[model samples]
Target chain A: MTTLVLVSHPQLADSTSQQFLKESLPDDDIIWEHIESLSSLDVAQEQAQLRRADRIILQFPLYWYAAPAGLKQWEDTVLTRTFVYGDHRYPLADKELGIVVTTGMPRQAFQRGGAEGVTLDAALAPLAALAHRAQMRWLPVFPIYQFGYLEEPEKLQLVVDYQRYLTQPQPDSLANRQDWFAQRLDGMVARLAEDQRTTGRLIASVFEQNREQIDQLHDTLAMIKEQDDD
Target chain B: MTEQSQWLSQQIDQLAAQQEKFTDRAFWLALKQVVAEQDRRSEQLGGEVDGRTWRPDRW
Candidate 1:
């Protein structure tokens, strides 16, 4: 899938989280754009990028619970009425809209009883509404809270998690996750050092075996349930 | 966990340790987590199958 990641950080180079994310981007069919970098908005080109992408990610540090002003400006310029249902043709229909939002506060702060007193969903309601109006599928928001405070392990986890958010299939189920990894296993194993290739291949083989075993068990359980139902 | 599953995880961990790149290590380690998940799911599904097989009413 071709994922379009539009990052709207004002000072892209200064934001450590944004820089880390750029480094962690998956090597695949991806298009990365920084909204603030563009001197002028090419409306047709911007719309074409939106049309080309299977999944569109809007990444930005939360500014008072909203995206940066640059993203808002881009929306006003590129997302024209006629292109997004004004002409009765939903160009973005069935495409996925994902948000990768970074917050200064911890995750706990984005709840009714927390310091921020509002959830990410509620804060980003306008974007959600836009997705609805465009008949787009809204992905669950991927929030990076308190990025500066994260230890090494959390950062390590975030690398893959962020990549998956951009490229992995929808629903984020174990099945889809397995499929995602399975698809990449061969390439990962192939990239291993010569001495480590055997071990890498062995590990991959075991993973695939476990995957198949689970599928078999699921099938068996389904059969049993079917029998019981009759 | 099954012996085989444990062995697989150990191999993955060792391979992850050998990788110099943080992201590469993360991928291997993350795959190990999914392997663990697969084992748990297999056990759950196996138990459900066993539970359904011996239902007295069905028999």
Candidate 2:
């Protein structure tokens, strides 16, 4: 799927988390645009980009529990009523709208009784409402809380998690996650060094075997469940 | 973990350790996680199948 990642950080270069995320962006079918970098908003071109993308990711740092001013400006300029729901043509209908929001506060801070006393969903309700009006599928928000404090392991995991949020199919189930990884295994194995190549292929083969085994077992379980229903 | 899964994890760890790039290592390690998920899910499904098949009422 073609994913359009619209990042709205005023000082993109100065933000370490944003820079790290930029470097970790997946290398396929993605169009990354920095909002503040654009001198002028070409409404038609921006609308066309939105039209072309299967998934539209609005990525930004949380500023007072809302997106930065730049994103709001882009929305006002580009998402004209005529293009969105005017003239009865809902061009963005059925498209996926996802959010990648980073916050300085901890994850627990966004709860009802927490320090912030507001959830990410509550903070981003306006965006969700806009998605609703356009008849788009609003994905569950992907929030990165306290990005500065993350250690090596968490950051490493974030690489794949972020990529999946941008590109993988909805629901984020194990089956879909498996398919995502399985699709990339060949390319990953090919990239390994000569000596490591054999081991990579072996691991890939075993992974595939495990996947097939799980599928077969699932089928068997389904059959038994069906019998029990009789 | 099953013997096969244990072996697979070791192979993945070795491959990840050998990778020069951070992203490549991340890919391998993240994949190791999915492999672990696969093992856990397989075990759960296997157990459920066994439990359902041993029904004394049906016998």
Candidate 3:
């Protein structure tokens, strides 16, 4: 199937890692839909692109353990309920989705037991769910790990490596790709969307719980702010 | 479980506040599944994939 890679790297021209990765990907079967070139995309066009592809990959560089702020903004603007959910099926449903993020640290910096001890997966967990809600298949991630370990000249390999990872699918291949955790949403999206019947039970349990807790926190924060105002 | 719930909630709050985005239950449910599967897959294969052998199953 054809793939649409929605790249969201800031200053992609200056990013050697992204450049190398893009260069590595075979032009056939992969369409690099650079969000940068799109400049400012409208939801209609974004939705159209999502509808057109069998797979959609988010390509960007990580900032503070997540995608640049622009990506969060991208999702907020593009993934609205009317087009992404509700009675009308989102353009992303059943379409494979994944990520490729370049970072500026060693892989050891992001993990449960490593230097930073905060897993990249944990950091990007929200994006994972968002992909799921959109009904896209969450493919494996392509993370350019230990980015600080490489010299500028060596970074092209990291980009090329990520491009190669996007070409493949399957749980095992996902784990071994060049950029670990760059793709943080694929597994869940695939599991949830690939099977719809069980999704209901999952929603009631996990989905409802997240909402409840989040609401509680917001309510608490609001009250505290009011107290401070008082 | 309470602590986990609280932490999860906090993350949601941070994202929503910073982004002005609503966190849908559907998104959370979908994300929960992704976390579960990512954990499972890592347990099973421990980071290894043959680049030549992957394909996208129709969305």
Model 2 whole-model lDDT (C-alpha atoms): 0.94
Per-residue alpha-carbon lDDT of model 1 for A54-143, expressed as tens digits?
999999999999999999999999999999999988999999999999999999999999999999999999999999999999999999
Q: What is the C-alpha lDDT of each candidate?
A: 0.93, 0.94, 0.58
| Interface root-mean-square deviation, each candidate | 0.8, 0.7, 17.9
Assign candidate 1 its CAPRI class: high
lDDT of 2 by residue, A1-230 (tens): 99999999999999999999999999879999999999999999999999999999999999998999999999999999999899788999999999999999999999999999999999999999999999999999999989999999999999999999998998999999999999899999999999899999999888899899999998898888787788
lDDT of 1 at A177: 98
Can you write out model 3's per-residue Cα lDDT over A1-230, one digit (the tens) per residue?
67788788768798766666665564347777677676577888777777777877887887877888777788888877787787665667787777777777787788877876787778778888888787677766667765557774345334334544565454544333312323322332343333442443443355444434444544555665575476
TM-score of chain B of each: 0.94, 0.93, 0.39
* DockQ of structure 1: 0.85
How would you encode candidate 1's per-residue C-alpha lDDT over B1-59 as one tens digit per residue? Answer: 98888888889989999999999988988888888998898888888888778769844
Poorest 10 consecutive residues by lDDT, candidate 1 chain B: B50-59
In model 3, which regions exceed 4 Å deviation? A148-161, A172-230, B1-59
What proportion of the real contacts between chains A and B does each prediction keep?
0.83, 0.90, 0.00
Candidate 1's displacement at residue B51, Å, is 0.9
Weakest 10 consecutive residues of candidate 3 chain A by summed lDDT: A176-185
Instruction: At residue A139, give the lDDT of candidate 3.
Output: 68
